[model samples]
Target: MLIRKALIEDLNNIMNIIANAINDMESKGIYQWDNTYPNEKIFSNDIFKNNLYLYVDKNIIHGIIVLNEHQEDEYESLKWKYISGNHLIVHRLCVDPKYQGKGVAKDLMKFAEKYAKENNYESIRLDAFSQNERACKLYENFGYNKVGIVTFRKGDFYCFEKRLIKYGS
Candidate 1:
């Protein structure tokens, strides 16, 4: 398995993965995403900015994650723990439903942490839908602390942060 930057050619596969994820979430009563968000346009922008990444194995795209510094405006109200330096914000983390339970999301998250450390980021921050138990548990299991909550169109999301490096250490 390898993680690499997403290209325009990968958009179709990425969209398919996202669609499957959306269907799976909705089927499970988790309305975290829909057609309105994470559309092709947003993903295209991520690709254009070199922020999107893909997890591929044997030429098959299994998952995707966006790592960047673009935090939502709602995050401003949250009292984040690590406020001293640059932060890597995780977004749009989705694995093809077919690849679910196969460690694809875990691998993607591992990649994000490594990327942040290599880039000298002070922390990693993300928001998981409060109702999405799988996502919230994943973040908590990975050592991320729930800093606060932010509400979006669907509902409230728990903001989490994992400090990667101490500023003075």
Candidate 2:
């Protein structure tokens, strides 16, 4: 498997993955990502700016992460600052439904961490819908601690953070 920067051509695949994710989450009572937000504009801008990260296996995009150099504009007033300088914010992270439970998401996250480290970032921060218990559990299991909660256009989501520094240092 290889992780690389996303390009304009990958937008459709990423859209399908995220669309399916939203539908699946709704089916499971998790109201995250509807017809709004994360639309073409967001994806287009990310691809244009080369801010999207992708994980590929056998030349297929399995997972995609829309990352930014700093906190998203919507999160500016929420006190969601990252203590670490040059922190990369994980805006949207979704794996193809077919690739779920295959550690693809975890691997993508690790790639993000590595990318941040190489660029001098000290940590990464992200948030997920409060109703998405599976994602919450996944983040927790991956060592992300709940920093707080914030409400977005869809609903409230738990904020999480993972420091890159050594434990208890």
Candidate 3:
């Protein structure tokens, strides 16, 4: 599997993965996503900003994520551990339903951490749906400290932060 910068041509495939994720989440009673939140416009903006990434295997996209400094507006109210300096925020992390338990999301996250370390980012911040137990556990297992909770379009989300200075320092 290869993870690289997303291109405009990959938008449809990316959206398909996201759609699968939405369906999976809905079937599991996780209301974290819907038709409106992560639309094509948002993905397009990420592509335009050069922050979106894709996880591919044999030229087939299986996962998508965004690594950048952009943070949710509600994140400002939280008291993060490493507040100063450049920090990479993980957003739009989703894997195709077919690749869900195959560690696709984990691979994307590892890539994001490596990207942050390479770019001298001091920390990594992200939010997982409070109701998405699997995601919350994944972040915790990855050593992210849950600092607070914030509400997004759907509902409550747990904000997590992990310092990268040990790797980047």
Clashes of each: 0, 0, 0
Evaluate residue 17 in candidate 1 and report its C-alpha lDDT on the 0 to 100 scale. Answer: 90
Residue-level lDDT of model 3, residues 60-154, one tens digit each, is 99888999898878988999989777999999899888978998888888898889988888899999999999999999988999999998879
lDDT, each prediction: 0.94, 0.80, 0.90
- TM-score of structure candidate 2: 0.88
- TM-score of each candidate? 0.97, 0.88, 0.96
**In candidate 1, what are the lDDT values of residues 76-119, reduced to their tens digit?**
99999889989999999998989899999899998999899888
Model 1 stretches astray by more than 4 angstroms: 166-169
Q: Number of clashing pairs, model 3?
A: 0
Instruction: Show model 3 residue runs off by greater than 4 Å.
Output: 166-169
Which pairs clash in the backbone of model 1?
A: none
User: Which candidate, 1 or 3, would have the higher lDDT against the true structure?
Assistant: 1
Candidate numbers sorted by TM-score from highest down: 1, 3, 2
User: For candidate 2, lDDT tens digit of each residue in 1-169?
Assistant: 9988888888788888889888887788777887787787888898888888898999999988877766655555555445646667887888888899999988987877777676766777889889888888988988888888778777788888777763344
In the predicted model 3, the residue pairs found to clash are none
**Residue 34 displacement (Å), model 3:** 1.0
lDDT leader? 1
Model 2 lDDT-worst window of ten: 75-84
